[model samples]
Target chain A: MPAPQKHVIGLVFYPGMTSLDMVGPHQVFGALPGVELHRIWKTLAPITCDDGLVIVPDTTFSTCPPLDVICVGGGLEQRAVVDDPEVLDFFHKQGKTARFITSVCSGAEFLAKAGLLEGYRAATHWGMREQLMTNQGVEIVNERVVVDRNRITGGGVTAGIDFGLTVASILCGEETAKMIQLLLEYDPAPPFDAGSPEKAGPELVEKAIALMQQMSSLEFANPVR
Target chain B: MPAPQKHVIGLVFYPGMTSLDMVGPHQVFGALPGVELHRIWKTLAPITCDDGLVIVPDTTFSTCPPLDVICVGGGLEQRAVVDDPEVLDFFHKQGKTARFITSVCSGAEFLAKAGLLEGYRAATHWGMREQLMTNQGVEIVNERVVVDRNRITGGGVTAGIDFGLTVASILCGEETAKMIQLLLEYDPAPPFDAGSPEKAGPELVEKAIALMQQMSSLEFANPVR
Candidate 1:
């Protein structure tokens, strides 16, 4: 009798990316049995997340093995990552045979930029819809987690949890995913109902937009779609 | 005009600790202006989370500055951390003056072990309630987030997000916290309703407890209180 094959999941990391976006899904995937997670980067150096937390990547692009799951997480530096050919090429090369190519938040931008999301319906952080819509042949959906064939994209940072569970159910089984959710005690009770633009109203939407604009010089006055 | 004083937040990190438990709150605190978050540990070496993720700590126990917030996150290694005198001593010294001393999940056990949560109402991961209840002078509450005076605790792993937002609102006002929520798009949409033990039912609860026990040799057959 042979041992069960390991599920290798490579999560792309870059400087200024949202630590929560990647860490949320990473935590979820890490709970599965026989699953190996790789924090992949261009180099093996420490990557500082946008929130000042630092993460050390375990695998470089050159050393990352063929992955069952290739996931990208978003941050204010999405525009910068989109233009980096090295990252895009890595995505293009890995997307060819990965069982799942996924993203959370503006991470969808990198997949779209790499031409992986072309002709696929996807989701991203609300503030990034306007910019992501610019990619040809991509249809951005306003959903928490979108699963179009093998491409699964989550909306914004916190949605990574939902996206991860969805993927876990797909890779393992619904029973296993539900058990993982239970283990994490993932029953969420957000204190405020202002999670979305519609729920937050105009004042908060404006404030959120302004706050995002202040975070970076990106043209991010995206209206609720 | 004088500069606004920075809010120093120290999040304790130990090997095999849950990354999301720390990162969720870290991301929220990092979004605030005039806030400094320190990933603190016994040494400056990279700490590997239980899920195989590596995080680089910027501050050590000896060098961490006076903190406005001192938070500990839970993991399967909670018992080992509780017995670690170095970590408990750091918590004791820091808890003396920190405005808010907090924990998420079994992290409450460390605070309890350090004599910080004495006579305090707190929350913790649902699986550890039996053991945590044995801590003298501590009253465990079964809630998502518990705020008893200056001691705040969150239930289980994913509750860290709610706990983070609650602390953010308390520190920086609800308006600013709301904006941060919008930026993260924290609207959660869990695909399954099996988050809590009651909601997850008997079969899943047994599975979750078995899974947790398998992670370590901890005595964790805690029934919901």
Candidate 2:
């Protein structure tokens, strides 16, 4: 027989968001038994990510049921999400009732802008951590994954896997998460040691920041639907 | 002005393929200058992955231009691909011209079925390694990333990232690949030590193999059109 109560997860998507930030966590969450995982967006249309990959949303913000967990991801396009009131409103409305509010990379910017992360210690994309600290009124952590109360945030693109496993452990216990980790072959062997600013050194980090700033300057025409 | 010659990388997608397998490499290759990354399948229609994620191919096999590299990802859906003649034909056709042929997880099965990996030493998902060895006429390499002449293969799901960076270093210089590595925050920190069969212990490995076998039995309705 089906479980009497069901758990639901809603992952938010928008144009230009880093696809890995979303899909990494999805590989963990979607594997849970009897858990309803919904890829939510403004509409059901296919959205193009920063690198030209196309992803289709499974549901819309308006039609999705009350979510147990709401997750968001970030990219250069997060600027548009920060400026969109409808998305902020959705986060706010959902934050009040959701058991956990989470983000990966700059995805936290939306929650922080929505005032959901006020006085909360969180993590963000290393490149964007300073910006979030300076303006978002939240204490920032530079670690891979940070969980303050129900607000969990992860560092840049690849941190999503760590973040996903952390979230999976919380929702379904350590054993289940460990099993998923093994299945995904979560052991990582980076051929380089430049994943973070501390490791990449100041010169390379500065170059990366400039590249990111240049990228963010490009306009994304994603309006609130 | 564009480079005199463009570098083309085509990653194949189909129903039930793992999304991360395709995307990890995409993140690396897509960042290179003058590099054209095409998500190719039989058509431009959306293909549902094993995890319910939908991906749209950028080009069709017939319309896709010549490729310097052709990549594939694997999952339970890969069995269907091995049984499809059209997909096998495409691999044989592309293998004749592509400078590099690659796969992640069980995706090597497609190339093996196409007779392209004959006498090649390759890697595949650990769970499916024995089957591949007993049947396919290819020597097996038990490692995260294996390179045998023009053929490169990665183990299991998450090895795609390392495989991607390896390929990136070959196409571009190490400096460029390292820069992309930093941009992607390629450093991974999985919270568990159970990523491999030895690490997860024999009991968990047996359980995992059973689960994988159960998963691979489901038929994917991905008719070659």
Q: Largest lDDT belongs to which candidate?
A: 1
For this target, which candidate reaches the highest TM-score against the unseen true structure?
1
lDDT of 1 at B3: 62
Model 2 agreement with the true structure over B97-121: per-residue lDDT tens digits: 9999999988988888888789999
What tens-digit string does per-residue lDDT give for candidate 1 at B108-148?
98899999999999999888888888876799878999999
| Candidate 2 wrong stretches, greater than 4 Å | A1-5, A218-225, B1-5, B218-225
lDDT of each: 0.89, 0.82
The prediction achieving the highest DockQ against the true structure is: 1
* RMSD after Cα superposition, model 2: 5.2
